[model samples]
Target chain A: MIARNDRLSGFRARLTGAGLVVLVSASALLSTPGSLEGAQAAQEAPDGMALYEAGCASCHGSDGRGAAADRIAFDDPLPDLTDCSFASREPDADWIIVSKAGGPVRGFSDVMPAFAEAFDDDQLQAIMDHIRTFCTDRAWPRGELNLPRPLFTEKAYPEDEWVWTASANAEGPGAIVNELLYEKRFGSRNQVEIALPFGFAEDSSTPASSDGGPASDWGVGLGDIEIGYKRALLHNLRTIFSFGTEVKLPTGDSERGIGSAEFQIEPFLALGQILPGDAFVHLQAGGGLLARGHRESHGTAEHDEDVREAFFHAVLGRTFTSGEFGRSWSPMVEVLASTHLADGAQPQWDLVPQMQVTLNTRQHVMLNVGVRVPLTDADVRSTQFLVYFLWDWFDGGLFDGW
Target chain B: MAGRWGRGPFLPCALGVVAVGIVAAGAAESGAVTGRIVVAEGQVRFAGEPPAGAEIDMSADAYCRDRHDETLMDRPVRVGADGGLADVLVRIVNAPAASASSPAPEAEALLDQEDCLYTPRAVAVRAGQPLVIRNSDATLHNVRVVPDSNPGFNLGQPIQGIQSTRSFETPEIGIQVRCDIHGWMTASIHVLEHEFFDVTGEDGAFTLPTLPPGDYEIEAWHPTLGTVSERVSVAAGETPSLTLEFSSG
Candidate 1:
């Protein structure tokens, strides 16, 4: 037992020299039940749990689980602090920034008020330490390791999201390709995804119609559908590695230049690493093989049934938030390479530059737009405009939380 | 030996016999009492009606559910009919540090996992003392400890009769131990720097006997309710009984 007194705390509203910033209101003080009693060791750092009780326990609860709705004045859903899967991933630095600058600094609800007037950094750090204790287990990976997703290179983190991507040729016969991808995450490290592609392209062989202009020379059809699974093999604070395999089914109308009719299998290893200064890199290498039975069964003489291909994709990018946290903008560049196993097959290469930006307050719904330029075989492959609308459905609804 | 802060029927002639009983209780594990009584004892209780706890859902583990004859209600504020509180920790916090601090006790503290629940919901053990954990259930169970001041450990026990041992050098209160497979299984371990501490049982009473004669501070703590502290003076052979009451608005 230690002696307690009403000694002045080192944390004060006057630290800013502009009088009290007024973060915690008088009503909040009244609603909370604890008296901020100063302890015996005023000269030393205050206990983390004790500070948490004085400053945060009103709404965050003593157990760090959110307080019951009836106890608080507002209705915004609070996060469950005891859930390690989400809590352990949030680094202390982000929380410190949010606490000092207020909720709007992180594009969060204004119900979370700033504490710049009431608590100093040391005091806030003490409170954060107590919050960390709520989640006892350490197996869940930290969010700092999850990096930005690239157009071609999938990051190694398991996700629950949906993405709709459309790519149109810039210089060739009018063509547009679109794909809808759905990903579901299960347990801690596993995810399954399905992708459906459909597109329209101009056909050069359209015959003229009687008593009318040439028949519309455009064809629309579905493309090869793909389903895949990914499992995180290893992860740490700075890096993550995963292994995945995808199977493509020959579901498209091959005669309309829409897809490869040959059934294919692709297996790949993906890695994501965090570099200094908010920069990151993603690497993916995979090999593709055709099902001989499906390829040989087709009576087409234009295709070779005994061919294999390998591909590699790499992306480098950095993320920047607008004025602390209004919006997150990530600018990325990717290098794509592909080669056939047949003799004297020139490797194909492309360069893509893109920008991804969050479109909502929750930062779950995002949009990325980019241009794909051919490096090798430029004369044969036309440049394309690519864009995708992504929704991290795991966080919330796509349209809500704006 | 039966000193109290509140009104209770007493027998003056039974004091000598009750003194011996208190000494044996103070010895704890198998050992003789080490010091004479500079008696300090108390009862911790809620001032009025005690708060209720949520009914624990144990449907995940069949073995645990079958072991209990009726539905089990967790008692966060375990109170007897007379308002006595259980699981409260009372200690002499201001005892002279030099003489109060002792080396780790040789006796082992037992924390058993039986019926998918921790045997004693709360306990106070001396720092650096060995803590023996045993899994008595035949099915899968695990012992998980996470302490901010000390290293954390997790052990998986798939079969019965599995025993794991651990010890903490730094003293920390309310170090949580839980089982991930069974979310309802949990226990609280209070590691103390000194030996002058006791946890209240169902009767909401605790005895910190044999404290040296002096003016001292005593503190009572609970997980849900906050804490209470008071100043007391203890003299040789004189029992000082105090009552600490917790109340909610």
Candidate 2:
């Protein structure tokens, strides 16, 4: 009888515990429904304050504000999303959609990636839920139309600054090269640039290499001056025209280098998008005419007198923040594709991948680590690697007047 | 009387607009929503056994804390080698930022590398964030991030007591981050951009805090366990606890 009573007592205790759990759960479940629903969906929300901190805070700032916007010194300015009185005109749903899909159509940076794949629907809702707490005014003012222009705090014209960039790179079977480029942008959408590049390779490796050439030293002496103009096609899109003559002085003594004097006219088109603050993407495409001169004493075989050729190239690039290790840093990547279309010659194709580390928004250092493979059999198949530093002293805002 | 223009057609248009405005205002003011959320703590099992020594963290502790506990679940268990319980990543998949002064709570996962192997073979964090990797052993280790879609980095930490904190700028799920110094040191990083996610503790307990109260989708992630998500209803100032069970095939 005593053992049976002990068993019954234990069973009763378990029942009481289960009952208490049920009662408490019921009470908590009835407390706040809307907020709980919003919170539950928070997992998939990409624009939530928490989400922004984990993904974008290192550069754009924790408060949805940025420091780069203040230093633009342009007539317009970067839009401040946290300005409740101004941003309230935009609907919350619209904001969430834009944040998830990105703002390229709205003239914002492509660097502000589309988070639909990164975040789930619930997490996206959570971010919208958070955004609702601030920037809550959603009524547009009467008779005021939205305008598409670069946001700046000062004037865009009278930009008088010079930027010089130099970079180099080395890899197995690739060239150790250096390049120096300088630029200055004036008020009339016309910019001046000077570029010089030098390269040397020990054992250059192509995709299909049967013979090896070790201790092969190649050097190039190049000088180019160009004038270019950029104009807006639409809100964030632009059209660029560059027509200039480049004079190259061949100085390579070995078989691996070019031994000829050349003149070229390069025309390029570049499209750029600036995100809320410092992040951006620049896509560019261009073609040019290259005219060669013969220098027989320097081992010239391909060109005896004058050879004319045309070349085209395209680049897609992005720049964003990286703060995983320490303070904020900018990291960028660019893919280059080009082809030289000349008569009676197999089209020359080259692919190059480059990585860049930013010292600042205006100054950056680049390292090109990929090898280029040539498809044309008649043209020499040479691999190229590059390391170059780039500086944007003018911020490209000088063309605002044009 | 005839010369005076009567406000006929214009009067009706003005009155109709006023009436519509009043009705819209009334609808906006009277709309109210109510609901509940039950936070289900996910389980972490290693080959049919509980995983011991697991640290679970949630981004927003306020909303889900009442239903969940702060202590690590399955605290006294260890995962077996033959595919039983392993430590899970307890995290908030997505949560909102509070304010400038009042920020979201911070969380961390410390996975040690001992005996030339990763302590926890899997981990998760927000993308574009920093992850600290260390070698607890008295040897050198090279950390190499192998990603398919983004440019990966390879770094060498050649001394003991040296830790390298690397940032992942791109969003890649289920990417492998391994060590070259010790060929056997392998770990996986699952990057999620949101804050409302959690991994199971050894005891199979998890708590999410700072929820604003309402319905939510609670998602549980595991290195080998895949993902399990459920809708939970939570009340304001109240905790609603729940349980999630998983079965293997």
Candidate 3:
């Protein structure tokens, strides 16, 4: 009889626990609807201007010049959106991706926090629009016009840049050539460029009595110093055309087989056309005229008189992106043709298959590598491997954006 | 057992209950306003000789020349017999506050390249709405958009029946689009953040419906004649008709 009484007490305790649970659940259910309604009412679409002021103005500033250095929390300085030279070149899609996914999406710093939950795609786009207003000047060609650089064909767009190019023979005599080119834009459509070329090649050190001797030594010296001027005749959204003239000076030691020992002048026209699907074409045609009665060096000249040559080069390529605002890769094929102006001179042809890739987030630094294969006269003209590193100084400093 | 349940599963259940309440409260409440836009008469004026039949030089492309039956002229202005402007855009500049509660409408705008020319010389689209660009010509063409307040894009369409879809994120007054292959091919687009916009037809009339009752700033824009704006007040259950005039100096 005592055990039966203990069981009755246990049943009573269980009933009380069930009642407490029912009470708690009912209270929560009763209060939830009101709070949910209030939250929903607050979730209205945000005004673009107001959102910009609240979210971005703290760092970017009201005028988009960036906050004063003292007031910022981070060590890295902010970008100046008002500078059209830098801001106008980046496409909207890139800005949106950076803002929404944060800087790391384009290999930038982790300090830029992701706002994936704070703003929707449309909201981010609206922010981009507001940022675009900082750049009021429209005379500078937009960044979309800056197409990929081809391996052999020069682009028509005037640029402020520095490029280092290296070429090595794939076959035949051991040789290595390098050139440093600096281009500066003076006005809206005019640019001046200077090129310094140097190389090391196997030298034939035979005595003067010998007519054709085998190379027995290696010599390193300067090749040629070239200065050029280019002017853009026409530039539109789809096409850019330019004309240029260059003068090459004899600089290296002719006896070392490192220079041509001839003063030459070249005039050329270049054209760039934007095609569908991020594809493009570059065309360049020029003629080189050597000064009359120039002495041939190292018995390298095929003719005794001054020689003139005409050349044509064409490049076809397309750009592909890693992501919306990420790295870009361009694969191009260049066709090169050259022939001497002298009678009975045969035309020579070469093909270069290359790829150019953007290395930095700002897309100002790039690298291109290619192989130049001689299609005609392979025995005389050796195949070469070419590589170049280009930097667009107008975008940002070397260490920036990484 | 009670303490464990309260520390884990119970917390989530409570939050879910709150979320349910928030969604119920967020139901949309919207009211609409209706109006008709009309253009005033005798407003078409030009500084130079009226371009009645100025022919375009299509001699560069034989394919373009063969597609046209007669010589095509540059017609910047198209007016009906009633002096009604066909392509004038009418939109609400300052939308009412109720727009915050109304969801953006979904629609697509189309621009077509036919016979080496852009059809529908001008169009208006809502921001974030899809814009379809079509190439119907046999020759290659590229679409280049230049906008001051928005991101620009240059797209190439090499094949016929090629179509591309894009959307503008910001509201711009007018964006110019051109074909690089044929410099003469051009089109204009206006992007708005709100749906309260329309283009006038042959009758020079436009209607903006489903707008909430409030004061609004209305703007009528023309590609060449410029823009005109006026303030208007609307009341519930009432339809308002208004006329706008444009002049060339």
Ranking 1 against 2 by lDDT, winner: 1
lDDT of 2 by residue, A348-400 (tens): 44444555554432122222233333333213334443333333333233222
- Better TM-score candidate (1, 3): 1
The lDDT for every candidate, in the order shown, is 0.63, 0.37, 0.63
Cα deviation at B245, candidate 1, in Å, is 47
lDDT of 1 by residue, A1-402 (tens): 000000000000001211111211211222232211221122124477876655566567778887676554457788888887667555566777676655655567555655554467887777776676677554555566667777767767877899998877787556677888899877667889988878887664577778677665777888778888888776655666777888878886555555555577777777777777889887776667777533311124335664566666678899998885568899999876666556666666678899999898767789999887878656656778888899988667877658
TM-score of 2: 0.30
Q: Candidate 3, residue A354: CA error in Å?
A: 1.1
| Top-scoring candidate (TM-score) | 1
lDDT of 3 by residue, B85-193 (tens): 5566788888755653455557678988887777666788877778888888766566767798887665545457877788887888769887644666777888887
Looking at model 3, the pairs that clash are A36-B21, A36-B22, A37-B25, B32-B210, B32-B211, B33-B211
Per-candidate TM equals 0.52, 0.30, 0.49
**TM-score of chain B, per candidate?**
0.76, 0.54, 0.77
lDDT of 1: 0.63
